[model samples]
Target: MSLILSRLKCPWCETPVTKAELKEKNLLQVYLKRQAFPCPHCNQSITLPERAEKMISSGLFVSVFLAPVFAYGGWLSINPALLFSLGVALVLTGVYFQKLQKVTASHE
Candidate 1:
């Protein structure tokens, strides 16, 4: 899936942005909000693509699909802590590696 190739690269300048820089700029939360912010290199506005949003939310989908399996394991001793940990891990993975793309074209 395209999610696997997602990176913090700028769409305009094609410059690679680091995760730390994004975190420092508090842009990580912007992904979920689909907010626009200036690119560090070119100052052009950029935002997360829908693909990124879905990817960021895919954790819930994944958990749903795996629930039966986990439920079986729960019967065999899987604990809430483990399930919670897995959920957190999936969300973290989604938060990272989000591809930044130029916002939709001008209102013209």
Candidate 2:
């Protein structure tokens, strides 16, 4: 009797991953290997999972909630402090989305 196996390819590079490869490496090692993945065909570098995780951290989630509040707090003359807070929030939201878009895209 023969066992059939399911294969997973690197999303960016399409490199075939074997079960043996996974068995020997820790998750962090696996993640780091992908950070600068060189596509055999295109040689494009893939984003590291940790970096992506950092982009989508809870701080960014909070920022998504906070940015608009700070941005529009004072419409006539936006308080400089409020504007600065809003700017920071906007940056966090941008980073969060940068990480999230990939996950969302995969589901669709």
Candidate 3:
């Protein structure tokens, strides 16, 4: 997956946002912060949804579960099947998050 598709975009202008920009505005500090950041392109204040934040948190948890399995497999030996499964899992997770982002509307 491309970085552009993974990162959150400005709701108003649809511009890709960097983590640094979000952190600078304190929007990425926490899931419950409810802080708003202005879009660099459209100047519209964007408030992230709590549901979206939760989705991301849960996604991380899911990835954590997979990480150990992959690590153990690597420790044993490189298995093509295991690697393929991991790649599929990652792609599915990315798709799931992208769908969540699209459905979760930002407060204008």
Give the clash total for candidate 3. Answer: 0
lDDT (Cα, tens digit) per residue for candidate 2, span 2-106: 111234355555675444554454333433444343333343433334443343444444455544565567556656465555556655654543421122233
Of 1 and 3, the candidate ahead on TM-score is 1
* Candidate 3 Cα misplacement greater than 4 A, ranges: 1-5, 23-32, 59-108
Encode model 1's per-residue lDDT on 6-96: one tens digit a residue.
Answer: 4567889999866567678776566446678777668788876665446556766546555556676766576655665676577677677
What are the per-residue Cα lDDT tens digits for candidate 3 across 1-108?
Answer: 122236667766678777677567665654135555565456566655554345444544445655556666665575645655555565556545552122224332
Best by TM-score: 1
In Å, residue 106's CA in model 1 sits off its true spot by 2.7
Query: Candidate 1, which segments miss by more than 4 Å at Cα?
Result: 1-6, 26-32, 55-60, 63-98, 104-108
lDDT of each: 0.65, 0.43, 0.53
The number of the candidate with the highest lDDT is: 1
Q: What is the C-alpha RMSD of each candidate to the true structure, in Å?
A: 7.5, 12.7, 6.8
Candidate 2: segments with Cα more than 4 A from true spot? 1-75, 100-108
User: What's the alpha carbon RMSD for model 1?
Assistant: 7.5
Clashing pairs in 2: none
Every model's TM-score: 0.48, 0.26, 0.43
Clashing pairs in 3: none
